[model samples]
Target: MSRYDWNDERHALGVATMDATHREFLELARAIESGPPAEFATRFEGLVEHTRAHFAAEEALMRETACPSLREHEADHARVLGDLGRFLQSVAKGRPAMARAYIASGLSEWFDLHVATMDAQLAAHLNARQHAG
Candidate 1:
């Protein structure tokens, strides 16, 4: 089993796109954490790429919906992306230690909290808007 399997209680948002994207995020994280050292860089890169796209998609939804927490959510995404970029740089330099640590611990914690708060709020907002429309 992978280190970070998607849990319905923790990861599901009830919003299809967001839930799917979050699942992909967890799957990528699991791959990065469990795969061979030789493949860590590649898997990590995929995760980073997936995260960029996922964030962008959610940001677009926030823009379309005029989400109240758009700025805050986007800021969180930016901070995490920047951190991931730095880790990727280190990994590229043949130093995957920091990135590995992040995958094993930091990333999982961040995801749980972020999904519970920011993404959950976003999903609720979107659902309400859709229902109202």
Candidate 2:
């Protein structure tokens, strides 16, 4: 595993797509943490774009599967996306340090909670569907 990459076996969901996306997320996080003035915009924007798409995809899956706790899960997604968006905006406006701090602290916490609860719920929901079918 890379510095920012999570182990696949440890993932909340064993879904291939989600696992791949999560790996990308961690890679981007590591990239941003690496620090380079010229590449900041590219890396940061990539992170933002990937994160939005990932959240939307997950939300759509949850909605389609009729996960019982989807509302709470989506709310958490919204919270994380909102914070990330703000961090991106801050960085775009010339505050990379602040964005770095948010990723290191705020985002790390969010990821832990998201993986432990929402993501795990998603995994269970999908696993049930697979078994039922």
Candidate 3:
């Protein structure tokens, strides 16, 4: 089985761009989780980069839409990105143990919650606006 499979129920946001970016997130997570120790840092870096871009894109959409929960959503992204940044620093120091543990345990759980809550709300708002306009 893949290390971190993205389930539709949990991962799909009903917004094409968001869903596609989320799929990439899961794929990168899976790659990092299953990659060899020697390649773990690099793989993790890729995930970090993908996440940075993903969050930025989402934030832009929220701003464009004037999402009601924009502040909260951006806060959530900031918190996670901060965590990822710290983990990246650790990986750069050749100390990927913490990062690996986070990938194997923390990340999937966090993604599930984030997608279900913040992302779902954002998607709903976006959809409503699309239908209204």
Name the candidate that leads on TM-score. Answer: 1
Question: For model 1, how many clashes?
Answer: 0
Per-residue lDDT over 23-105 for candidate 2, one digit per residue giving the tens place of the 0 to 100 score:
77887888877768788867888988998899899889988999898899888888877877887888888888877777667
C-alpha local distance difference test of each model: 0.92, 0.79, 0.89
Ranking by TM-score: 1, 3, 2
**Alpha carbon RMSD to native, model 1:** 1.0
Candidates 2 and 3 compared: the better one by TM-score is 3
User: What is the C-alpha lDDT profile of model 1 across 33-73, one tens digit per residue?
Assistant: 77899999999999999999999999999999899999999
Better of 1 and 2 by lDDT: 1
**Local lDDT at 28 for model 3:** 88
lDDT of 1: 0.92
Collision count for each candidate, in order: 0, 0, 0
Each prediction's TM-score against the native? 0.97, 0.88, 0.96
Q: Which of the two, 1 or 2, has more TM-score? A: 1
**Which parts of model 3 have CA positions greater than 4 angstroms off?**
none
